[model samples]
Target chain A: MGGDFHWVATEPSGAGRDILPADAVLFGNGRQALYAVLMEGRRRFGWRVCHLPAYICQSVVQAARAADMECRYYRALPAADESPDWPPFQSRHEVLLSANVLGFSGLDLVPPDWPNENRIEDHTHDPWSRAACESRAGYCLVSLRKTLPTPDGGAAWSPLGLPCPSPEALIPGHAAAGQEKLAAMLLKRHYLSGMAVEKEEFRAWQIQSEAAMSIQPTSRPLPVTASMLPHLPWRRWRVERARNAEYLTDRLLGSLTAPALEPDRREVLPPPTPRRFPEQCPFAVVLLCRNRRERDRLREALIQRRVYPPIFWPLPEEAARRHPEAADFAARMLALPCDFRYTPEDLEEAAEVIREFFQTEAG
Target chain B: MGGDFHWVATEPSGAGRDILPADAVLFGNGRQALYAVLMEGRRRFGWRVCHLPAYICQSVVQAARAADMECRYYRALPAADESPDWPPFQSRHEVLLSANVLGFSGLDLVPPDWPNENRIEDHTHDPWSRAACESRAGYCLVSLRKTLPTPDGGAAWSPLGLPCPSPEALIPGHAAAGQEKLAAMLLKRHYLSGMAVEKEEFRAWQIQSEAAMSIQPTSRPLPVTASMLPHLPWRRWRVERARNAEYLTDRLLGSLTAPALEPDRREVLPPPTPRRFPEQCPFAVVLLCRNRRERDRLREALIQRRVYPPIFWPLPEEAARRHPEAADFAARMLALPCDFRYTPEDLEEAAEVIREFFQTEAG
Candidate 1:
């Protein structure tokens, strides 16, 4: 809870609504929402194969596998500013999946030429982004647990008002997982507020709750999460996160090329913009390093300054083998926290840590 | 939370300390404890087969199967008052499991002739009974979660002070399950105290937490349970339960043979004594009916009068087929809960309901 921004239980203030669709079907976690959507798609539209981003979380691949659907990978590297490079469409019984990576871009990952009815868009990073709000994809999915201060919640909805599947009645394991996660959040809140609760206590809850949720992929969301949805201040959180990400991006721009671990052997690559659109509530202000060694060094330096940045993912072995560029992008990238939990001062300190690391390495 | 007794979280008052052994190994639930003991036995003594009671919970069989040990059935019928009849023991590589069923008898279920080194005894119903306290078996296991107000806890120890395997570590799933169950108990406490909490909320937590615990068959107990074990009022609870059970048994003694469902075809079978030893804290005051039909009729009548009696078990298909008498015993038995939750007036009301049912059936 202290090392990274773990969610905490919050009072339901009823400050916002419409963060998700009124009819959004909720599940235990993001992967379950995705799995449910895939299975429903297979049932209603005869979707057989799903094309997924090469740069993705392993759980997504697992969800697809659990749905008994064949998966094909497409290029969706972090450096790509626009839509993923489209693979040839098999007009029958095939679906394409796209994600707004780290909310760095608008929800326009689905290529224009692709059939709109066969596309599934994941708006987990920034569900409030304008593009996501006006998404024309067949279905949209969001991982509410990641963004909201709730124990367990993943939502799926058809933006076009197509028939969607509702989750079966809540299962006991999933319910327990939600409760466990909720307890962790509550305990973390106590620890954060200078209470006697230990950090290990909350961490244990977070880890165990995830293990429980992983095995229960298609169960209904917890009752607490469902009740808390309308009360969450989603809009305010999004705005604050956007401001933090923008500030960090501007602060880090000048020293982007300063840390060249192998100056003589390689040409300096221009760092990509932190966000493709100004309107996005970016998940984080991402940095591109010269290599994995440099990224790891910067990560340690940030940690020393009490700035905990997360690696987007370690590419799954199959994806890494199939798409080396995606793997390389994953290796070179690190994400600085720009969530609502941070303030301007926190970002300033984090920015200073990044600059100091590069300056020290350059020396 | 309201219909049947579920655990309720209580403040640790340090009123009891010797309920469990000082070095007892803790687990997520009773079945997990059993599984851990079987696996440990296999590792230490090369034990490959386990003889389990025919009238037993399915989870116990599943646990033995999970440990890759062959299971053989024995006649440990509910009607048997003293020790189970001896089955040929393969002293070289076989283990025998016995239980103090509903705490009706002492920890003397293991035949006098059987080797103490090859016996495992379950004291789930009455861990504090005199016989359990003085057990001489190689191993003893108890389902602490069922008897205690803690979320999740099972314990394993050797009465002979022999080698025991400890849980590896607290896994995330087991930890979460404990938290969920704890939440349920807390909610139930509020409900019992006439709080506005919905009964379903706590009930859902109870159901889900159990599912979470079921899959984790060999994990450490929750930190809360570990800390609370030393403080639980175990002795007081046992004594209170014993008093309630004794009172109910006396009240029902006169009407025992009145419910002759088919008066002409069979001689009335005398009801077995609720407890073989008067000093025992019975898990429940069990009533043996004439047949399954009478048992079902009596169960419904009791429920209508707000007295919920649980069936010990419905025999697993294999067991039912292998031992028809055990199946018959299971079908004809209804356990009237005499746990510490009920007051004297509550027991009086339940006793009235039970007597009323039999009188109407006799008419």
Candidate 2:
């Protein structure tokens, strides 16, 4: 076996002494984890209706669908106080999904009157949030791939310490997935190094490998992935990500109106403010464009400089019909990478590129 | 990029020109396929109650549980005519799992009056049975790995041309599972080729790899696995298996009890005749001991000689309660491999080994 052949994945554990007990299971992806709790809840409590935010990953909907539950949604927007603004809904027996987008928000958004046992936090983008992991909701869920180098890992655990099936039972499925990802990781390393190779073909192959994992909805995380969980420099990475997000926000403050930087409280008209996700070890530095055209233009400019910023989603037709705000967010939002891999200088260069794009537009 | 590195999986296609229409989707295992159809049926038709044979793989129950449906099983006994004797209960909206075990039985057992639209055939063990592929059930599902060397693959298709999602979408999950399998395959090859490896250590690692695949359910067959689909010598395997079964049955007629060679219409107390399963590619050659004690003794004897014939299962408590016959089968039934890989002489050696043990016991 070569040194760079198979990658070490994130170990399945809590920050300190809290090993995600046997009751808290880790799976191949976030959706699978979400599916697990929904299925468990449905089987024991006859919960057939699943309630989640309109502004969430498509996988969340897919998870509910897989669990054979009726999906209903309510608003999940950042309020003026920068807390999650969960809209009121009449859900008696529905399983509610309380999600934290970009890691910082939504944990505080549960409607106080709803049964706490019904809420499952979709902390897919907020794996390291102390509040997310420590929450007293019936279940706390997180996806590791978004914040870590693991090929695939999603976790769901009982906050109440209920007895749950051990994820070890799902390992056969993880091993299957691990085979393809290991090859891709090796191929990626080879490509990233000075070795000459066909880049696009390799990339397409890697994408194909990744696509295969999504279809395996109920598998467990690989042992190699589970091994590195405790070793991750969580606090440092979290701090660096927060620092990077703050830095980018301060630089892009007046130049590009970021709603996340500080919510506008009122308008849906002019360019939306950059919504700042404070205190969270974010998946990316998110920015909102005035319109799709402006977003596309900035995206193109960034691409030319070899800086790739991904859009939140393309928006499914059903989702678009259900939440127009989500559709708008999909059209105009851009996510800049700020994971543990980047340095302050690298982020500075990326921010400068964004500044140049607007300055050129004004000229 | 070693030549013997990764085994190319079968290129997915329906048998012959049918290529399993676009409506047919493949997955990582048979349970995943079962889970898929169950979830789809529950979501689309308000099908919440699931009915399946008590005599089945543990994964079938696991899959049903994962789908969050109410599972109610019925007793299934091999009919006097060698077909499945399915007990009748009034079911209007319930989804029925019509399954084929040992690739020879059950398909013929479907009640003529039962709604075909409500039936989903678990043909994981019966891929080569022509009648099974031609069944009129709403969905026909199979796991390719049981019949093929591909590390992980499961397929579910609508024989009725129901609209289904493209399996290509699940490739990422498959790729993730593939990497672990490829590594294990490499290790297996190395171990087999006189590499002087630690046998148990390698086996544990391989087991870990397989465990990962079970976790990553709902994934597509790998492209490599799909590529080899057409090339698999299905006919040859079926013929070799049939011939081997007949030969063993002819030789061991009064000396042993084989449920799948040529069924004895009358006595279970007498020396058992071979029950025929001609024209089907079987997972193994079935043998039943007179009692659990004899089974244990024979199993140990076979192990001492390195001719390992595996017990069907060590029955689960719930399964044992629901289907005592299945539990009995599990305790006494043993399956001997008769795959394409075995040569005539190799099979003869295995058959002779069993013959010698029984002859000594009788003496």
Each candidate's chain A: what TM-score?
Answer: 0.91, 0.84
**The best candidate in terms of lDDT:** 1
lDDT tens digits, residue span A1-363, model 2: 011122333332345234343456778777778877887888777788888888787878887888898888876643224444454545556778888776646346456766778777777776656666567777888777776666677888877764443344445545555555655554454344423334453456556546666523477775445545555666666677776666665666555544233233212211224443343455566777767998899888887887778776776898889888778877877787766666778777778887777677666
Q: Candidate 1's residue-wise lDDT over A1-363, tens digit each?
A: 114344443344656468687878888788888888898889998999999988888778888888888999988864534357778887658999898888755545758777888988988988877778788888999888767777788888988777877778777668777777766765565455444456687777778777777624478776656665776788878878777777877777755545454333222111334444446667777787878998899888887776767777798787799898888888888887777888888888887887787777777
Candidate 2, number of clashes: 89
How close is chain B to the truth by TM-score, in each candidate?
A: 0.90, 0.83
Top candidate when judged by TM-score against the true structure: 1
- For candidate 2 chain B, the 10 contiguous residues with the lowest summed lDDT are B1-10
Model 1's alpha-carbon lDDT is: 0.74
lDDT tens per residue, model 1, B253-351: 756545464433222111334444445667877787778998898788887776778787898787799988789888888888777788988888877
User: What does candidate 1 score in Cα RMSD to the true structure?
Assistant: 9.2
Q: Which prediction has the highest DockQ against the true structure? A: 1
- How high is the lDDT of residue B231 in model 2? 49
Residue B51, model 2: Cα distance from true site in angstroms: 60
Q: In terms of docking quality, how is candidate 2 classified?
A: incorrect
